[model samples]
Structure formats: structure tokens, C-alpha cells
Target: PVAAASIGQVYKAVLRADASPTGERMTVAVKCQRPNILETVTLDLLTIRGVVDFFCTVPGEGNKKLRQDAQGLLAVLDLAATRFLEELDYLQEAANGARFEREMNAVPVMRDVVKVPSVLLDYSSRYVITQEWVEGVKLTDLEGDPKYANEEGAALRADVVRKLLNAYMVQFLETGFLHADPHPGNFLIQPDGRLCIMDYGMMTEILPDQRLAFVEYMAHLTAGQYSKTLDDLVTLGFVSEELAKDPAKREVVGPVLAQTLSALYAEGGGLDKKVEILDQQAQSRIGEIGDKLEELSKEYPITLPPYFILILRAFGTLEGLGLSTNSDFAILEECFPYIARRLLSDDSPRMRSALRTFIYGGGDRLNVAKVEDLTRGFGSFTNAMEAERKVAVTGEGSLAVRSSATPSGQLDAATKELLELMFAPEGNYVQELIIEEAVRAVDSLSRDALVQVWQRLPGAPPGAL
Candidate 1:
């Protein structure tokens, strides 16, 4: 059999005659350890530790003292790495697989979206996983295929994403057990359209209280409550209280959070209306935001809880797969309503608590008035500002403009600073003053140079930025 993976080679095989209960033929996926897998694992662990040390230390300010401190930090990290590697026994992995199986069995959504392969435990040893074989096409194989890029394809992809998200939500919120790996290759789209998830070697669990906090954070984010979203993030342990309290950090994270919320909400609208245009744009914007968030993770040093990281990576992978199958599929939109419904259901105590909080906070008092305002004013301000910015930046005038008229370029200083930060070359921020100086230098340059600087900046439009 041909090798199906790098770390482990998968083979299609029949169940051993002695193991077959009914003398029925059954295909199984046999995963064998790659040559020198222990060595590879050690190297990978070392690499990861090195990266963590670099991010946790590397000087942001000039001082040999800081460098010496960083060296000490790296020394600690090396010790931690040594301990971690020492404990990387196959027995640990087997224990993890057992835990994953137990968790999956406890979750209802897992029964629908995930396939925990039937393990031949007696035949399987550590470093090898033998499970029932699943016959299906790889999600990646459907990418760019005309058959999967039309309306039908969009619907199918959206449905898959919806199921995937729901599964993760359930695992993260309800059971607190989640699949840590959800890459496209790990998923199989059956002819019946059922999604088969494979691999359980990597999984994480969240506490029930943590899961509730996560739900609240996501709800605030989707509703465009920027401050509340940040607050929820801190409460949920996604961001530290110190970071949230920092005015500059808050200013930076707030708008970015709002933009993310807008994009998510817009995607929901697209899914509701079945608007391909909005869906595609939302997905693209989300991809861009994901990239920015990765950068932000480095600067802010926010240590994401393992369970949250699993869900984030899963959702991101699902989004990418959805895009590949149908660029117009509004995955977030399809998933949001499901998540909202789940969150608001009578069964969830967490949702009930949030509802009570809202009602007690005068939400019920202003429900009607707030509804009207949202219906009338939602997106209007942001959209108008975005339109104006586009016109100013592109020098394009709509019908009632004189050719010689110059639109006054107005942008908040904070916004300008953010743009400058986004445009700065990676790892080039020597100091806080350097960023301001760079922005000022660019501002003083020729119009063409300024335009070049703006073009080089990494961000979306004001609406999606």
C-alpha cells in the first residue's frame, strides 16, 4: 500500500480473519508509524519550544539587559521542552485516544459530523492507530471543480461548514471535548454528503464554565458589541485583564474586533439571503482577518486556551475548505444562526443566564426602539465612511463632482497609526517611536510615495478592515 501521510502511512486492509465476528469483509485503515518517528517528534518539539521562546522573549526594546533576560527565558523554555519530550510516550498518546473516544461518545453532535473509527485496540499498539476505513473523496479534491463551484456546490459546502461548526460548538460548549485537528485532509465528504472526520490523536477539552464564557464572547462579537466583546474575551481568558485595560491596546483591538464582527454579521446576512456576492466577500475578508489575527497573537502575547485554539483552527480549516469548494458559500452565516439558536435554547443554562443579564440591563425596555434603530442605522455610518474613504483614496468622484475638486482626506490618528502598523515590515518595529516616526515620514513623502505606502499596507477596506 502507498503511504498516505508523512508521520504515519495509511493502508487499506481487510480485517484479520480471526477478528471478524460474522465472517464479513470489511476494509480498515491501518496507520503505521513512519521511520524514526520518535526522532521526528523530538525535533518538532524542539522547534516548537524554540518558537515559543522567541515569541515570549525577543527584545522589543534596546537593552543588553533585556537580551540577557531573554537568554534566561530561553533556558527555562529548554528545560520545559526537555521535560515535555521526556513525557512524550506512546502510552500518553494511547491515553489521549481513549479520552477522545470517550468524549466523542458523550457528545450528540459528534454522532452527526464526526466518525470515530472503530478501533482494533487488541491489534493496535502505541504509535499505530488501526480504525475502520471510510470511503470518501477528500474535501480538497473538490476545489476548483466546476461541478462543486455552482449553487448546489455552495449549498453543500455551506451545509458541511455548518455541521462542522456545530460539532465544534457542541464539543467546546456542551461537552468541552473537541477535535484539535480539522484540516481538510482530515475530513472526507461522502457521496451522501455526510462529513467523516478522522484522526483523534490530537484533542482538547474545556471546562463547562470556560465553554460558557466562550459562547458569551462569540455572541458579543457577532452582535458588534466591541467593548463587551473585549470584556468577554478577558472574562473568557482569551485576553489578559492587563491587555484589556491598556488604553492603546484596547483602542487597537476594539476596532479590529468590530470589523471582525461586521464581517461575521455580513456573512450571516449573506447566508440568510443566499447572496453569493456578500458571502464570497465575507469569506475573503475573514481570511484576511485571520492573517491579521495571527500577527496580533504575536504582538499581544495572548495565550489562547488549548480548547479555543482547537476550535479556531478547525473553523479556519473548514472556512478554507468551503472556499475551495464554493467561493461564495457563507459558512459563518450558516453557522451563526445555528450557534445562536443553540445558545438561546432553553436547554442551555448559560444562554438563559445571558438572557437574564440582557433583560435586567434594560434590553427588554428598549427592545422595540433598539430594533428600529438597528434596522434603520445598522451599517449606515460605517458604510458611508467607507465609501468616502474609498473616494478620497482612489480620487474617484461620483456624478455631481467637479473635476478639480479635491476630497479632503480625513482619517482618525488612531486609524492612521493602525494602518502604519499594518504596513510596517514584519519584525521591523524597533520601538514605539519608530512606528510613529515611520508613519510621519511616509506622510511627509510625495503623494505617489504615500500611495505606494498605502498600497503596501496589509489590511482590508474600512468596512472589512
Candidate 2:
């Protein structure tokens, strides 16, 4: 046996040719469910329900009530219990793995680097799952192992981590089907240099509207609009409308959220600097951020929705990986390009609504600076993707040969898309805003300023201005 957990143990085995999916003898990993795990899980759940019932009905000192808290925790626990029970059925896990493989292959950026092992359904059962054996070290072990601690090793780890992060981004922003168990234990760095994602027992699906709300959440958070950030969270089913609308709770919760989330912006300048300022303000009187959160949970009823919990778990695990690999790694810096690409490229009406909200959420005024940032981010992301495609087509070993130059073809396509959006009937308001902003800029320029601009143009005649 190679690995054992609470519910299962994995063994190395050689499958017979008749049982193999390819009709050839091959080594495989057989994961067998623990004996009588269902009864054990049932007992544990019953005990938990009893405790939950007790707390929900019982009152504490000073007549402190816990019904609201218990109710919220119960909802999350029920969802978790359902997933855990599903894990006992190995066939369900196999189905989850197959679906994940299909989704990962659907993304061009991930198809080459990420993979899911194929399941041998003929050998698999409700109690046993058989999959093709893969040889590699756990991703966590690669960071500090002597064989992978040198310069080359560092480069490989960095590349692998970037690809892994991109895979998670695709799951969150595009696919909506996310692997909730994203810890280091579930990922292996194969000898052939591909990331093997294992253990699909705990997967979650986000509704399309929820995914769009999350995209908007990232946009608002990056812009340092905490109030709108709260609104996005509400739309995401994180915060109850009653709790979010309460003026007193907002006064306390807003700053705490800012402090916790701004930790992602601990690098770079400009917008990052602004985020740092907000963090500093929020941390003025903190005993500890965790303590504050605990106190808030006691003071208010904060529900942990299943999807929201899974999202946080995945992101937190990824952030931990980033920090372990590089002391100076900033999660937001690594994640913003993905968010920007989605914002610019996704043409669904919900996404278009999100983009408009991002631009005008602050007030009636047009946020020209925000629009400029979006375009710049999109261009950089497009250039990087183009470089990656070229490298993949050429069968290059790494990104060392990737070019730093912009790809004009992608930019031209983006420009065309923007033009179509601008002239479309639904975009009339945006068109008016753009023209008004342009005329305002020109009207504000002095004759001397106009002359300077004209003289700076290519092939301008001397004294033409």
C-alpha cells in the first residue's frame, strides 16, 4: 500500500490485460474504500447533529443565543456531509475525474501542462477505483528537495506553479466546475513535467451568475471600492442582505475585510500602494485579524455557503503554495492578468454588465483611468498568451526563449471587438461617454499645448503649429 487515509488506502497493482482499458497489461493504482466506512461516517454525523441541536436550542451565559450561528454552520455541514458520503462511492469519484479531464483539455493554456489520470472502469467498482499509475514526487516535496533546489529546479517549480495557478483561474472564471480539494497532497509533479491533479472526490459547481458575480468581486476589490466589494459578495451569496445592509455591522465588517484581503496586494506600487494604505488604516487597532473575525462572527450571523467555502479553501491553498515557493510572491499580482483577460474577452451579457458596473460603479462619472488599466492589462495578457502558443507549437522546453514584444495581431482583433461593442445599439451610452471625454480633453488643452502635441507628431513640419 502506498497511501492510507481515513476513508481509503491506495495500493500498487498490475492489472490483467482483459481488465485494462487499452486491452494491454499495465501498472495501476487501486484505491479501496475502508471497511464499513459508511457506518462510521453515519455515527459521526449523528453525533454532530446532536451537538448542533443542543447548541441551537440551548442558551448561554448572559442569554447569548446560538440558533443563528448553528443554522449557518448546519448548512455548510450538510453540504460537506453530502460530498463526503459521495466520496465513499468510488464510481462517482471516477466520473468526477473523467469530467475534470475533459474540462482541463478544453482550455488551450492548460491542455499541455495539466492532466488527470484515466480511470479503468472495468476494474473499478463502488468500493474500488483503478487508475493508470503515474510516477512523480508530491509538488510540496519538490520545493526543498536537494534534486530540485538548484537554479534549474527553481525555474521548473516556478513554471509549474504558474501553470497550476492558471488552471485554477480557468476553473473559477470559465469552467465553474472547481476541484475543492486543491491541497498540495492532491497534486503531483510528474517526471515528464506535467502536473497531475488527483483526488476529485470533493468537487463543486458554481452557477453561471455566481461566477459572473465573482469576476465583478475581483474587479471591485482591485479598484479599492470596499463598499461595492461588499455588494459583490452579497450577490455571490457570501453575506446575507440583512447583515450587509445593517449600517452598524458595515462599519465594523468593512475594515476587517479590507485588512484580510489587502494582504494579497503586498507588492508593487500605484494601486498596490493604495491598497497598502487601506490595509494600514484597517490595522490601526487590531489585536489580530483572526480575533477580529471571530469576534464579528459572534456579534453577527455570518453564513458560510458551500460554494463560498470551497472557493476560499482553493484560493487559500494556492496562496500558501505561492508564499512557500517565493517569499515575495503576491497573489493579486499573479491573479490580476487572468481576471483582466476574462473581463475583456468574455462577451456574455452578464460579463458585459459586470464590465459596465466596474467602470461606473463608483458614480455617474466615466472612469477613464479604470478603462485604461483594463486595456493595458488585456494587451499584456494577450501578448503572453501569444508567446506561450508559439513556444508550445515549436516544442520548446521552457519559456526562456519567449519574446517580450507585443503581438499586434491580437491587439487588432481586440480593437475590432471593442469597435463592435461601441457601435452596437446597447453601447450607445458608452459611445456618447467616449466622445464626450475626448472632446473635453481637447477643449481643455491650450493653444500652446496643442502646438506642442502637433510638433511631437511624426514628420511634423518645423513651425507648423
Q: Which candidate ranks first by lDDT, i.e. highest?
A: 2
- The per-residue C-alpha lDDT of model 1 at residue 435 equals 58
TM-score of each: 0.60, 0.76
Q: How does model 1 fare in lDDT?
A: 0.56
Give lDDT for model 2. Answer: 0.74
Off by over 4 Å in 1: 21-25, 47-102, 108-113, 144-150, 242-307, 325-332, 346-349, 357-362, 366-465
For model 2, how does the per-residue alpha-carbon lDDT over 51-163 read when each residue is reduced to its tens digit? 88677666656535467767667777888888888888899999998898898888876676676898877788999998899887787677657977677777667666666
Candidates in order: C-alpha RMSD to true structure: 21.4, 6.9
Identify the runs in model 2 with alpha carbons over 4 angstroms from their true place. Answer: 16-19, 60-65, 243-260, 263-300, 357-465
Number of the top TM-score candidate: 2
Candidate 1 displacement at residue 464 in angstroms: 53
